[model samples]
Target: MTKTVQSRALSLAPGASRREMLNLTGAAALASAIKLAFPSGAMAQGTGPEVKGTRLGYIALTDSAPLIIAKEKGFYAKHGVPDMEIAKQASWGATRDNMALGAKANGIDGGHILRPKTHLYTTGKVMQNSQPLPMYTLLNLNEDGQAISVSNEYRDLNVQKDSSPLKQAFERKKAAGKELTAAMTFPGGTHDLWIRYWLAAGGIDPDTDIKVIVVPPPQMVANMKVGTMDCFCVGEPWNEQLVNQNIGYSALTTGELWFRHPEKILGMRADWVDANPKATQAILMAVMEAQMWCEKMENRQELSEIVGRRQWFNVPVADLNKRLQGDINYGNGREVKGTNLYMKFWGEGGATSYPWKSLDTWFVTENIRWGKFDPKIDIKALVDKTNRADLWREAAKTLGVPGAPTADSRGVETFFDGTKFDPAAPLDYLKALKIKRVA
Candidate 1:
């Protein structure tokens, strides 16, 4: 897809006053001018229920932009949701559990979730829950430019650039009598799923021959240098960080799988929305606006600054911005431009804030494929339950950005094995799988 990211930047302060504006056409100065003239005010036409207070939880990642942008840009307050205590949780599991407990017990109302956690919590197919806090995906963060990187030793073994080099590296490592270990941030998360999928497609056994471990993003580089693992498949800055430090090199990027694959979503509990429909709708509208703002190409430098702050990803802006703009450095002193995978606002590259059922359905199908949940469940109904695109459309239209977002969140995925996955028919896909499923 040809993206028309407006070259805009956030002219606001470091913390909350900052608002990113979308600039189309790559006109840098025009994009900056647009950021200066963004239409920010109380949203009209939404008669949301009165929200006495608003609270949301998130873990630090670039994908958390919608939530961060919504807050910094005053979209929440404009939508009548101010005084939210944006808590920085310790881990992805902690974030989800905290939100689950808080939302359920009248603590926090909504949260950001790693896609798999959202799927697991919302469906309760395997981990049965009393309240199934059915989550609706509000919007997509970005099509991640995730990658799997390996040590310099593996690179010398002849892993190429055009494809999944990490997979090839794994094969080379096996021949060398070294067990390949790959690290992902969260289990059942996009990082984990992508890494495993990448490995499996390369003919490596993600479950057996290859070992998988969960490591925080920040620690990935350190661990690699110390030999905790050979390579890590993770989000930008981390992968880029590895490249800059000369400890490793890029094997393959997850975007290589599907460049525009849905990577992250705004997730909230079903009961939370049930009691606060107006509030939920308002929140969706605010985040949707933020998604658009992030689409601007010019606002990237500023975004890199905000995301790199200690309060967020806690890294240097140079490291963050270098990759944010697609200029990549594959450690061992290699640099390549056009590798930035950061998603810009105005729904960069057709990425919307609202959940696409097809995206959710894809995750659901993968959830069953990886044995994270049961394949016997009603996957179709569950996907529908987990995605609130219908609600998001109503709110987005009322808020006046545009008309209803499409409900194209369902489809079939054809893999290299000549396998077809109609997410609508996940059970059949599961039955046809060649790999063993966990009992």
Candidate 2:
């Protein structure tokens, strides 16, 4: 059998590189033989991964579920990553800082992060050190779980989906010589973009009309209770906590803003991926399997129980289960039963996990629209550099999942406000926005 296998391998590759030769051979059997022979000296000459320990970072949001589940449920270990370390980051800023530190210095190798921040770091717009950190988004973590929660003061004003009432209140506050403040998790991040778009859609300028503040996700509820912010946008449990505490009400979910909108992503430093491609693929496969588990409706209650532990989110299991089960209470006596727009881990048609480059392009355009980055920068090049759809496709193919219909674009996406974003012409879409900071 050994001689026959050798002959087959040689016939397939008369003259090939060591890696290619191993690929032509039966890689699984050859890998086992190489490990037995070498012990710890060398790896099999194959396309198989170099198994190594990885330190992953995650913030305390419900969308961080995939990474958390991957670690807690032994998916990482089952996929050849037995020494994976899951670190809970204090905030998104801290996650980025740890990722910048890299894995060698006890920092994170990768993280669940904001999609736009990947572009920001790649363009050197975020961390302005002499050396910029280039990052790649391997996959989107989850979609449409975030929401805009306003203070109880707006309840009587009839502020639900439409922010026009909130805008009027802002104007009234300004006329009274007071400031109306709105908060997001990070500047130029996903929450920031959502709140800005929501405000701007109602004819309220996010920059000049109101003050925007930055608060961490875990701190959002406490800050809102103390009247530090009028309205804030963030992920689950925190928003529901506000409603539970009777301090605020959810005006609109992000899903209501843009259905299945891309949110947190699985991000890694570009250099790490370049040096450890196989390890990166291994990590993605584990996370993707965990994502498939998270998408199961029957598993959500158990998921909430697991993620709600003190070691993880530290929130009540009930709060996490509320949104996880798709039961939304607006905290204004309006309840939506069995809604389809809850947080989606892996949506039908591979929508949630696939890192669409066009989505990254849209984020870059929004960043340019908000003056976070220069409009003259090459949007396509930036998207190509940061969004690692190719890597995701490879991982999916290895896992036997269906590939995305297209590599770069997800076609035209329409928002709730009847705004259509054409990925092919991002600048034109930006030009059409009536209430934007850019000219």
Candidate 3:
């Protein structure tokens, strides 16, 4: 059977595309042929992924490493998806827009996305189109790599992890009729949430205390250099780029706000997954392999090089390497030597990749806390529908990893400010926050 499948696959025209092959021989036959052609140790005998070419989108952030790595290192091809396309989006908004376009429109099948944004997309609260675009998270991309950076002017203000020092500066600026401007990658996104939480933790209301603006990740340094914004929160290379340019200092890493907090996620449309379960599993399997590869210490150098390429992140490899290896220089004469707060792709105990429903609950509740959505919504049900842990388990199992665990919740999550968030009582957690817009 293997020989027959191999012969059929080899018989196709050399330059024929996967879609063309599918049109010629149907999806099931193409999947079988491709499966036989590129059999991995974990490949099981079953209906393989549909042989449709997937255009996976990603922003120019370091957390996008897994998707780029999978495409660059042939992991996607090794898992019987040879026609995967890794697209570089301009910003998170563009990424979301493309995902909403779906595969038929030549948009993305999926990509790295903010967890809560997926909820917003599905609920039709935010989008280019009003129709609800139901989505699900297959796995988390990375954790602990995002940071808040302030201009060099704040270096002497004694601003460290807390924003207390900036509060006085903010008041002076406001008195002078110049409202201090703060920037994040997206409104109600992870960076926005992180910056808001950091500011509110320091008694600064994000909405009332300052002017918050949206800036793309790659353009963060340029905007900061021109003194357009006082401070900004975004994912790596940009934060590290600011330090490299000597224009700003890393005031705080997001990991310092909430240890091992969820950052980017592998989000896909639910209807896409439902229609193409095998293809979805194949994509997840490839990413799972890439995640394990990215977690290794020895592979950091190569990983950095691959992601820092002109086509991918378009940044210097050195800037990307520093954070990945945990050798962080805060650009304020404060050096963190060998910190464990480096970006984690796949840690022990299934911490990084597993799409814990609890994290989703926190994201949704925070959206409510920030007044992006109403508090009357069912948080648990939203999490259950948006987070597809069952799909992650299926992919992990296909990779020869352990089966799905008994529970989906990661239990109570604690923050650096000593605030505790129990997923079971999200409203209680919201009520505990002193500065919030939620009624």
| lDDT accuracy of residue 408 in candidate 1 | 70
Error of 1 at 144 (Å): 2.0
Judge candidate 1 at residue 343 and give its lDDT: 42
Candidate 2 regions off by >4 Å? 1-48, 128-130
- Higher-lDDT candidate of 1 and 2: 2
lDDT of 2 at 192: 96
lDDT of 1 by residue, 296-413 (tens): 7788778777877787678877767766677766655566777544444355223445567777777777777787777676767876666777776687677665445565743666
What local distance difference test score does each model get? 0.66, 0.85, 0.85
| Pairs of residues clashing in candidate 2 | none
lDDT string for model 3 (1-439, tens) is: 4565557676655455776566534567777666545554125434556664488888898898899889888999888888989888988888878888876798887888876778988898878766788998889888889899999978898476788889988899889987588999887889999999999999898899998899989999999898889999999988888999999999888898998999999999898889888888889988888998999989999998998888787789988999888888889888887998789998774568888888999999999999988889988888888888998887887777754454788899998789999999999999999999875
- Worst-scoring 10-residue span by lDDT in model 3: 36-45
Q: What range of 10 consecutive residues in model 2 has the weakest lDDT sum?
A: 8-17
Compared to the true structure, candidate 2 yields what TM-score? 0.90
